[model samples]
Target: MERILFGDNQFFAVNHISDEKSRAQAIKFQNDVEIIKTLDYSIDAGVHTFMCTTHDRIATICDYIRSHPAKYEDYKIYPCMPYAHKYANAVTELGIVGTIKEYVPNNFMGSLFKGGVAIMSKDYLSIMELMIDAEMKMFRNIKTPVIFLQNVITDLLLGLGMTEVLVAFHKYIRKKYDTEAGFITMNMPKLLDLLEKAGVENPIICTSINKAGFRMSGGKELYETVLKTRKVRVIAMQVLAGGAIPPKDAIKYICSLPNIESILFGASSRGNINETVSLIHEFDKQYQYDILSNF
Candidate 1:
């Protein structure tokens, strides 16, 4: 079976011996774990500010928390979205004790979103700090804080009513590849240019990478080439090559990647959580591989 790992940053799945359904199940498990953890943290932190909405899940969470008296919160409820007033009222009747937050429709991409705003946690802060420090050392410059700051500026131009015809000069270079199938290859500079044109700031980029028919030396060279451009923020993914690595091997290999900031992992149960945590704790950064041979 493929062993999965779930953490605050991302969910990762790797299997060399499992079927696709098991992978889907692993992702679902990760989603469930995150929800459960959210509630548990709220209760543990003694923060009564529980946010919920008309999504039918509010009731279940409320009942679950209420039934466990030791874990109850002061319970200020927010409709998952502002328009869910009727559902919000029903939630209030169920004994939740707070008003809903106001909403502006145009800013929202959909009628409802996961929380209508971005949620940040300690892990996120730590990762941001790590990125900043890494960029500083890599570039040896303090004025430019993020690696992708320039592109972000270009993307913002669209907001100023500038037409693409004037800015079409930005798309200057392109490249094609004939690498193995499933090998994720991205043109770093081009991607940053695109993100800039769209007004994207320093968002962390995530994508899958495949290591097939190549040794660790080949992988290292490929990564270094991308790194030199300073345009692409690269992170390795699909390291298991679609279940190409056995579960035990997946855990060890993933834990071994030194350049990886955090592996996105997914889980389905408490057992998955425990195993993942254990692997994280067991990671040894001292292990070194030739830049191209490790992958």
Candidate 2:
């Protein structure tokens, strides 16, 4: 994983703080060209990895990336799968059978009639694998070194005591996609406990880690303790607390922490991208200096 990961929340109008900002972003990125341009800005600012949801629009972006191989030769995308809204909207429009027919791979279509049987038999692991394969279709041939399970599913599984499904996802991605499996969750402490208990060692987790305790389940102090003690690789998201904390302060706080392997953030413009990247680098240097001084 890159030390700094560029996120897609801005491109998809996912503002955590202001509805007005979300609307504005929706308007600004209505075109794939504008989205590509902003991504170029991030690349120019030296952030190569794009950590994004597997939204419908992302397939178009993948198409564009596929078209321009030389320009994005080193660029990577961390695809967060099963974009919940996509499935919800699909169910509303297409219904269950239609949705399954549309998403399930052609080769796997032979088992379509067994869907009801699978559901009745509680073969959820098989269903989960099928869904993962379906969601991964768009990212085909893209350099997706890390595939993330979205928080919507990760947290739900945690609440359901379905640690086995989590383990299945982790193992499936490694075995099938040949990539590292990452989990995005709001409740980091609980998820880590479950993953560790399931015998998953040094798992990759992306979660909210900010100064304001914004969406940090189990509060900030617990998260701090987990970070210091846990062996997992954490990619800190929501570090700005929806723009409540100053950029420098947010980056400083994250950099001061232990086991934070990366920082994930979204920005709409080159200026914001450069500023955030610079602040991360600045604070990271300071953090290393403080560590060396203590030594």
TM-score of 2: 0.94
Enumerate clash totals for all models, in the order shown. Answer: 25, 0
Clashes of 1: 25
Per-residue lDDT of candidate 1, residues 53-163 (tens digit): 223343444445546554442343211111133435655765331121221222332323344334322233332233223222321211111122222222334345443
Ten contiguous residues minimizing lDDT sum, candidate 2: 112-121
For residues 194-267, could you state the per-residue lDDT of candidate 2 as single tens digits?
A: 99999999999999999899999889999999989879999999999999999988988999999999999999
Q: What's the lDDT of the predicted structure labeled candidate 2?
A: 0.92
* lDDT score for residue 279 of model 2: 94
Clashing pairs in 2: none
C-alpha lDDT (0 to 100) for residue 233 of candidate 1: 36
TM-score on alpha carbons, each prediction = 0.35, 0.94
Please give the lDDT score at residue 13 for candidate 1. Answer: 34
- Model 2 clash tally, residue pairs: 0
